[model samples]
Target: MYATFPDLLRLLFVPALAWAAYHDLRVRRVPNELWYPFAALGLALLAWEYVLVERTSLFLVRAAVSLLVIPLAYLFWFVGGFGGADFKAFCVVALLYPTYPSYYLADLALPLVRTQLGVFSVTVVTNAMLASLGYPLALGLRNALAGVVSKLMFVGRPVAVRQLAAAHGSLLETPEGFSRGGLDLDALRMYLRWRGVTLGRLLAQPERYRDPATVPAETNDPGDGSVTTEPIPDPASEPAPREDADEYDDPWGAARFLDDIDSTAYGTTPRKLREGLDVITSQERVWITPGVPFIVPLFVGLLLALTAGDLLFALMRLIGLV
Candidate 1:
């Protein structure tokens, strides 16, 4: 008979997956605070599943699954095929869902391979990988329908630089792996130097809120912390010549002119504004790479594995391959 998670176990595990997916989508990072606690709980639940439920045979099967899967997850991470969070997520999945969790529904149409293997986490991973194929395929189809080709190579269409920066996706590129709106590392370095702020400091304190206009550009060498530029200029006393364009400029618009020679004559522009200007100038158009958070696919995979069983197994059966 096929096995599944108990009701209590499902309740705990599903919510955790939902939370991880949300965090990964929003910030591209999941904090230790969320996963670490969930991991502890997962171990506890697995223990209970084995000891209290007295599913000794299932427990052994699950243990074997964990031994097989966790190392593979680690190997993916080690080989740079997986991100840190994605790797940890898989590890957690191995512990929490070593075998398919139970649902009190009629058995779904499953293939002979799955019935023979009966490893829950393996089916979930396979299903998620299969589901993920839809994203790029859809993007390619859209590009084909739109009559767009050449630079994007039918993987993605050229999008405006501003739009690309404001949105999120894997940036597309030519065969040479270059795109118009993609960040120009060399140009970015020069911009960062002129502003006298290092990327390290900016990242170290990303949460600090600052008015884009008011952030003072660094006058010190980020390399050795020595004075490299003049002190912050004051516009009140030595007013920089205002351009006619400044009259129509909003805060973001004003940022475009921050690098203007005359504007910096009176005062240093804000660091934040400088950064925005750098990004805007980085590229005119970009090929958005087709990538999605792996967690998203994994979450979908988990649900399908619970409701439908192994996708590849079912497909094989449908095609009379197994």
Candidate 2:
């Protein structure tokens, strides 16, 4: 679809909401002031899409759904981890994003993630529909043709006995050209040729196959049998325990995790007083936020929109009007 004014408005709300959610998920809190960017963007888009455009009919419908849904989504959140900011965010989005295309009825409204997660469960039925009406089996047809061709081939006459004997015995000869020397029969057997092919030298001539290059270093069984096939190092296999995985590489990481930001910051690397803009811009410790999910006030204005959208979506589905 074209990047209409409405679509452009919707795009404004995504990045800030995504960032807010990232921090909220990380630190369990979102800063109170962080909601401004999202609010400003969303309001601007809403004005453009709703006030300046011709989506008035859809607008009226969403307004009504908004009144009914705004309360319920917040209720579910307040009693749980969902905070006020997240609740409000959902409410705003419900009024905006979900208004497009009457999303509830469209065949492609939901994507694969939703489909896997049990939204619009017609997936299996669709696949079965294809299977029942699709092409006939291919394997049985191809094999039947091969069998017919094999039966039509003529057999050739047998060769002389001496020629056959030499073909079979040529595999055992090697350099020193001595017919063999200090022969390790195991290596010889391992390298044996088949179908008149030398099996790549060693199989053809064990006498010449003793070099380290030709005979892989590993193929040489350990002298004292100290290493009797130390299980093939499979790349798919888990590696031997990592050295750093067990070591305490970070001197202060553990302390930071348990302490609050202010407490941890006291012990953090102090800012360098260098006149050249200090070696680093800032080095706040992770103990408090450790990352963003661990941060507190884990709510953003858009969260309210997501839930409001979800519930608005669910209720619409219930009434078959979404």
Candidate 3:
């Protein structure tokens, strides 16, 4: 565990970053607002290493890996292989867990017990051991931990998980965790007013009801709030509400849609999905093709492999029975 600290540093940071990335993706835009704090966090990690630890390799390696992962991460995001922000967060994570190879390639040059491949041997064995113990082992461990935490906290009512089943127009039965952001009517209106969407119609078809979360569910409308009665049908009832369904599928289908067709050299409109890529070369300059010399190789290439190898040695050296 002590030896795993450096890798853990990365493990802790990237998931937090990835969460932000997922939020940015949902909005179909990355917020410029978030960039500053993370940049500072990255800087702080470096500063701490220099000022406190004096291990320049830790600072330098972390910093260098962080910087290097960005472009490749972006490329993965661009190609739709991952969310833009997920790629960004994962790049940093790669630095954290060289053995995990978070966002990059394994060191092909150094294989055997000297690189990540070697370290993975331990992970495989450990996971196998866990599997052998079976589901009961994990459940027992979790229940035990939860019981301890509850005891320390002085157990109250278990927090109810609320879900708002605002499926129908009038009878919006909020699940345990559902709410309309108070009596704010504007939030509902925002969904109704969103441009290009037949939201009102979708509203008529409550089955197609989206989360109050599509946009900020806030409002200036002051009233007791609207009301009615009826459960909204499941959104799937329609001929697959084209808008909501296509939002992701459309983009993804773009690649597969063209996979069957042979494009003419004479400037045939290759379709929208095909448009994201440059058609000049058959090479994957866009989504779908795992571009050669991927970001992982360039970023954490050597370190990742070594970390893996070390894990195996650690088992042999540390975990071996005396």
TM per candidate = 0.62, 0.31, 0.30
Comparing 1 with 2 on lDDT, the higher-scoring candidate is: 1
Per-residue error at 224 for model 2, in Å?
Answer: 66
lDDT of 2 by residue, 187-286 (tens): 1221221111122322233222222122222222212111122332212221222233433332212222223122221122211111001111111110
lDDT of 1 by residue, 1-322 (tens): 3444454454566777888888777655576666676677767777787787757886687668765777898898776465678888887777766655554435643322354576677888898899988876777778878787664544556677544323444344433445533332222333344344444433333222112342333322212111223342222321222333333223322344345323231222444343444444445665655335688899988778777788898898899898
Most accurate candidate by lDDT: 1
What lDDT does candidate 1 reach at residue 51?
A: 82
Task: Give me the displacement of residue 63 in model 2, in angstroms.
Answer: 3.1
After superposition, which runs of candidate 3 have C-alpha atoms over 4 Å from their true positions?
A: 1-32, 57-62, 91-322
lDDT of 2 at 133: 30
**Top-down TM-score ranking:** 1, 2, 3
TM-score of 3: 0.30
Better of 1 and 3 by TM-score: 1
Candidate 2, poorest ten consecutive residues by summed lDDT:
272-281
**lDDT scores of the candidates, listed in order:** 0.56, 0.32, 0.33
Off by over 4 Å in 1: 1-7, 54-58, 105-114, 145-147, 150-154, 169-283
